[model samples]
Target chain A: MIKKIFSLIIIAGLLTVFIPIILNFSFQTDLPDVAKSYVEKGSKDLGAMNIVTAIIVTFRGLDTLGEVAVLFIAATGIAVLFRKNAINDKRPKQISKRDSSEILLTGIRLLAPVILIFGIYIFLNGHLSPGGGFQGGAVIATVVLLLFLSDSSYKINHKIFGFIESFSGVSYVIIGFLGLVLMGADNFLDNRILPLGEFGTILSAGAIPIIYTLVGLKVGTELASVLDNMKGDIE
Target chain B: MTDVFIIVLGLVMIVFAILALYLKDLVASVIAAGVLSLFASILYLIMQAPDVAMTEAAIGAGLLTMIFLLAIKKTKQIEDPND
Candidate 1:
């Protein structure tokens, strides 16, 4: 039954997908006008090396904001669903995870900082590279996961998580408002709020880098907090 | 060369998927699935979608695997109370 259903679904999906794809698709190298505009004007207008980053953080700022908000909601939902695992549980837990070896501990201590710096590099270089806020944030969460595994007693303070999460979220909205205030109504989420510095440098891309950084912080905190909530508290 | 690499990766990924399907041990199956995801991420990297590749590596291979392992452990602990 399951195989039959799966095959039926696959057939239906292919039937719906291939018709539009084969009919509307063109092999020509020429892009649509909108894409052409984005390619031609993206770097000059946004001063970002990555045209994709410019599109996400500037041209399609509202969509990115919505994406961030959706992630925040999903994280919140996970936390709520796992409410029993929150830090305040007083139940005596089985000592499941054993302590790491000294060598492992030492290795983690050395490697964690490097992993962290790489994650930050991805965050900071979003405009100049393929990685950006979401990728960088996941890398940060991986760091947190490493720390959590190496030591069970490693407690993530709610204060710090809340601060980073809320601060970045609020600041993201404020930055959008700043763009709206500085540029006209049509220029909401404008990267031109800050000076679009020389391209390929860290300081380039007006507010795109700042926005991406804020997004990274927000996403990282949310993911870390989600991991924390899932860590069934040790007694 | 790239085509050969792609073919090899695709074959390995299919092997992992089939192993995951046939494995009796849940943990082994989960590991196979994680390996599959990691391969998919590598394929994304080769296709120049580093953003998608990074996400698949971190979330699909890493986080989801950890979560599934934990869930399996919890279920086993509950089921075989003597263990």
Candidate 2:
């Protein structure tokens, strides 16, 4: 009872401290100068219909690259921590575990392809829509998770995932270098390597789609590997 | 209308967050946390940030919840009152 009351008191105190700030907050009526310029020229400058994508993929491209590297490091750390458990297990590859229900297996089989397609579509059309590489990659990882849940014996091939992840990471860096070599130091990760075609078209965002696609593939494989590492025996 | 929805969602999220903090069952706490994330994503959508909403829903609600559940499976499922 005392704990509950104390929690309530803390909550009330927080609300008291926060309410004034919330009430005083006013929406911005006009875009700031940098934002105004981006809103005005982002589509033309990057050929991306979605201004947010343009900013994330090109205007702050280096940041996105850094974010991908961070994710890779995290996944690698998990894999390394779990590697001993994976190597020590000498159980037969075909150990018979209890099978999942027929309904679940059937449902996953039916929905997996569609979900895969949707994930692909999200990253592919990221330049024109609100979705992007990270979101789409997460969605793809969800499919892998569903498959794992439906089949106790199902195992993702780490070799394939590793190849895809490394390839995408190297290609992403190569593309960034391409921008630097072709343009200038200031244009690293610039999407203007290819001509910015028609506005609002799927292929019009120059290399934004390609970059996002690489990011999606890398993120998807990294997340899947993390999930796989976590699925090892706890003993 | 959107303001009202956001306000309601915010309140509900707070309730879920408190529930998550206080729940004795670890699974229930994790689920409450996930529900809070789900409501937060909806609030983001109502505020016209679909990209952030997608991320909050996918990573925060979906993957984070699943990871928590998996971690709980590897450990204790209930909180010890004395601890």
- Every candidate's DockQ is 0.46, 0.65
lDDT of 2: 0.89
Worst 10-residue lDDT window, candidate 2 chain B: B1-10
Fnat across every predicted model, in order = 0.48, 0.52
Query: Model 2: residues >4 Å from true position, as ranges?
Result: A1-24, A85-96
lDDT tens digits by residue: candidate 1, A98-207:
77899988888899999989988998999998889988898898888899889877888889889999999999999999998999888888989899888889999899
Clashing pairs for predicted structure model 2, backbone only: none
Query: Can you tell me the DockQ of model 1?
Result: 0.46
Candidate number with greatest TM-score? 2
Q: What is the lDDT of residue B13 in candidate 2?
A: 84
TM-score of chain A of 2: 0.86
| Candidate 1 lDDT score at position A104 | 82
lDDT of candidate 2 over A54-102, digit per residue (tens) = 8998888999999999999999898898776456656646545788999
Model 2 Cα shift for residue A124 (angstroms): 0.2
